[model samples]
Target chain A: MAGDGRDERAWVRGAQAGSASDLEALFRAHWARAYRAAYLVVHDAAGAEDVAQEAFLAAVRALDRFDGRRPFGPWLHRIVVNRAIDWARARALRREVLAEAAVSAVPAPDDPPDAAAPSAGILEALASLSPEHRAVIVLRYFLEHTPGEIARMLELPRGTVNSRLRRGLDALADVVEQDGEG
Target chain B: MTDLRTELEFAPLPGEIEAQQRAWRVVEAAYREREQLPRRRRSLRPVLAFAVAAAVAAAALSPPGRSVGGWIQDRVAGEPDAEPALVRLPAPGMLLVAAERGPWIIRSDGSKRYLGDYEDASFSPQGRFVVGTAGRRVTALEPDGDPRWSLARPGPVADARWAPSPGFRVAYREGDTLRVVAGDGTGDHLLARGVAPVAPAWLPREGRTVLAYARADGTVVAVDVDSGARLLRTPRARRVREVFWTHEGLVAVRTQRELRLHDRRGRLLRAPAAAVRRELVAAVPLPGAWIMYAEYDRRTNETQLVREACFGRGPCIAIGPSRFFRGAGRLRDLTLSPDRRWVVAGWPDADQLLFLRLPSVGKVVATEDVRREFDPGGSGGGAFPRLAGWCCARASG
Candidate 1:
């Protein structure tokens, strides 16, 4: 039997009983995983934090409704994932503006920052990917979730997730190749 | 050259995930502190007793049958209107609300010469008329605040919305039945009956309206308002928070997860199912596009902004660390200028407005203190957030 799972379940039970202390314990226990999950998708610290707290809050509200048979971590992780997706959709306009600004601010090939680091170039490439493609890469690589896990988390078919993982890898190869050329 | 995905797998860009977890603990502690009772007890028994005595004396002294509204009018009826405050319009003034306390129509200046209590108030896209509910009364008022007409419905009027183009229709809830009134408040037609819905979302391109009913377990039901024919029913979305119809199509923000975009026929438009794991504070639709503002990374205390094309095929843009502050608070209620040039970012807790020059190089252009009504740093303290809705007008060429 998983002792940590029992403790997590106990904390959830305590939270359901109006125990703020238990809720805080639960937040401390699960917040990092949730934030990491969100960060892998949005790649933004602030947005990840917001998603983590909201996910925790949602978990608290629905704690009583939680079937004790299942683990709470996955359920809470689902909330974080959903919140990040909504945030991505809502900020569509601001991202456009930021991308335009970023494109304009990007230095030329011979700029001073060009030789700063190969890693920066990789980041730029990752950032330049479509949110969907970027998410697939982040889930498959950054978060280290399997195609099956990603498919279940995203509510897509396993085949779709596998194809996306493959295509995402191909796109990443292109990006890294472009950076090497530069 | 190493493949980017291979390298990313080997070494993830450091994002203080552990620190963020610690910060979330602090936030959770802070909320618990607020929940702790007897922290501060400032009683008003003495003040309440004195106020009661004064009210009794005033009531005894006043003449009979003189209502409070009447008495106030008698005292200040002839007073000149107050000077109009030069408050900046957030979104081309497409949506206008009187500065007065009640729902009475005030001339741009703070003067309530006309008196009509609306349960709620809204301005048309042109700002040429007002829509509101006053008890069982639903009325449309011209720009001058004069009632163009009023409709007395069967149920207590719940909510009223107007479509910007192709004519206007108002949705009202009477008991459990939902009804729609025409532009003139006539032809009191039963659009869909037995729907205890919060509000109806008018789908773009199509005249069909989507409403979430208790029967649908809060899953949104899209129906053609004119014909009452059901168009589409969204799957049972878990913890569905908000559904908005953008210029592109219908977008539903399901809690802290994915923003599903659906066409009028309810087909998923995007592939790979793009998702963000942040709690979205607010979303503002741009001209043929939309912007989402959300809080990110608990410890870092930053927000993210995302951009998506609304009209047709275009790549989705995601901007992270949009704004960062020392303290904790989520971004709420973002207002894009009518021209979509400026964005007013509101933080309900901070009661602060970050006036952003649209398209800033991934950073806030400026932050301003505009928290007269909103408590910039208070926890769920005021109704300003609820009353802080904005409307965008198509730019006039």
Candidate 2:
């Protein structure tokens, strides 16, 4: 999730003390995974960028008040994932109102925008799941957070996190198997 | 079988590095430009706390006391020409104002009635009934503040707007999903899900129910609510804030950076070049295909209200000179009068409501002590009330 905890703490302390290099080091270390988690949930490149950027901006805004003893990844991840969920929910709402013709006209996520498109297998499977399920999976697997940790990060009950994980895994399995057969 | 964890852990996130590079620039710039507020010292905290508490208690106990006196002194000393209070509206219309207490309906003669504890509210097309939201409940209340009907959903309701004449529909957002109900509070159904927080704008047409709203993906879409037909979908804007259906059957989309106008068929019409790096705060469509917008420049801390009108066939012409409204802080919430004669803005720093005459700069009215005016009988430290809408010209009897 983040680099060495000791190093991260030192960076946080230095950044709070007005060290630009420490802040850059912190941002550079965490920006990739945060953007990845956001993109996995929102399924939009530009939106993921916006969500991740906003999260970092929020972090910068709250840097002075942040406690150095706490790890910064979970805090930043919480903001990124929540905003990604919001973005996904909003996208779903807009898609729901699309006329049948327009809905059909929109391209599927599996359709590659360019030759350098990422592997469509897992990403396409993940796209079938709702944003809530996507968020749980991203936190659990990509960020390597345990269910309890994820529950706390997401502010969801442990039981709810387990159930979401179970349901999301089942859905992903079905999509991957179907893609293999096809 | 592919391990789900392995697949997720290794799944390619295209453009990760590029996205980070771009985002870092913005984040670093913001970090460099942030204004650091001085932290209070621990030694004198108790004394400061006591003083603040006493001031708050004193303001609560007396109306024209210290807080109101400070507001008046600030206005009179700072702006000698500003009006003392909202004695009368510059134009004919009821105004929907939301304060700390709830939504209030102010008549043209400055008579106001609080409409219960709704978080946000709007007037029906005829100003006959007001639809207000409190938590998850959307209630339709008569002008007298009596509830005609209420619908409670699972999620918090917000951005409720009543469709224009033949006002049979009310569209509102309930926790990211857009739902529509009959004006009589029946046939409540989901119109769309995943809508941007921006309120859906109804095409002010008779005999048909069409609604335009921004999708989360940044596209603006207009759909026929009755037939479930997609009439138009404009190309995605980066981050859309407001959408308006203009008098010429065109849609105006306001993003953080620009204002874009599109026809009913989703063709780009015109986007006036914005001078300076000013952010668009609010905009309203005026009669005769004219538009007025409040744009704020962060560097100067000023908001300019500009009027642009499109005549016959040629290019849309900007009318007269843009009026500058300066304040110590941001001036926002530009609401036009029902008769299209005046525009009112909320200036929080000055604790005043500015009423500027339209078309050309005519008479300007600035009402002071707005926080005390809206949050009467309470601590005068509440946020300035928002000018939700200036209702239609007809007074409900």
Q: Give the candidate number with the greatest TM-score.
A: 2
Against the true structure, whose DockQ is highest?
2
lDDT of 1 by residue, B1-397 (tens): 3354555544343445554544555445434432442222111101011011121122222221012222222121110111011123323433233222223222211111222335566655555567777668888886434689899876688657664554467666666677777777788777666554455555545344444332236455677677667777655455555556665565544334555555556555543242444555566665555545454434544455555554434334544433322223455556665556666555434333444445542223221112211111112122332332344454221
Q: What share of the true interface contacts does each candidate keep?
A: 0.13, 0.35
lDDT of 2 by residue, B126-184 (tens): 88889999889999998646799999999989999999887899999998889999999
DockQ of 2: 0.13
* Model 1 residue B257 lDDT score: 51
Per-model DockQ against the true two-chain complex: 0.05, 0.13
lDDT of 2 at A147: 95
Error of 1 at A143 (Å): 70
The residue pairs found clashing in candidate 2 are A90-B194, A92-B193, A93-B193, A93-B194, A94-B193, A94-B194
Q: Write the per-residue lDDT of candidate 2 for residues A1-182, one digit (tens) a residue.
A: 46799999999999888888999999988988888888888777766776687677668756877889999998888778866765565445334434334774776432334234465788878888988899999998888788999887665679989999999989988988899999
Please list the residue runs of candidate 1 whose C-alpha ends up more than 4 Å from where it truly belongs after superposition: A1-182, B1-86, B97-119, B174-176, B193-197, B204-216, B251-257, B269-277, B296-303, B309-327, B361-382, B385-397
- What does candidate 1 score on TM? 0.43
lDDT: worst 10-residue window of model 1 chain B: B76-85
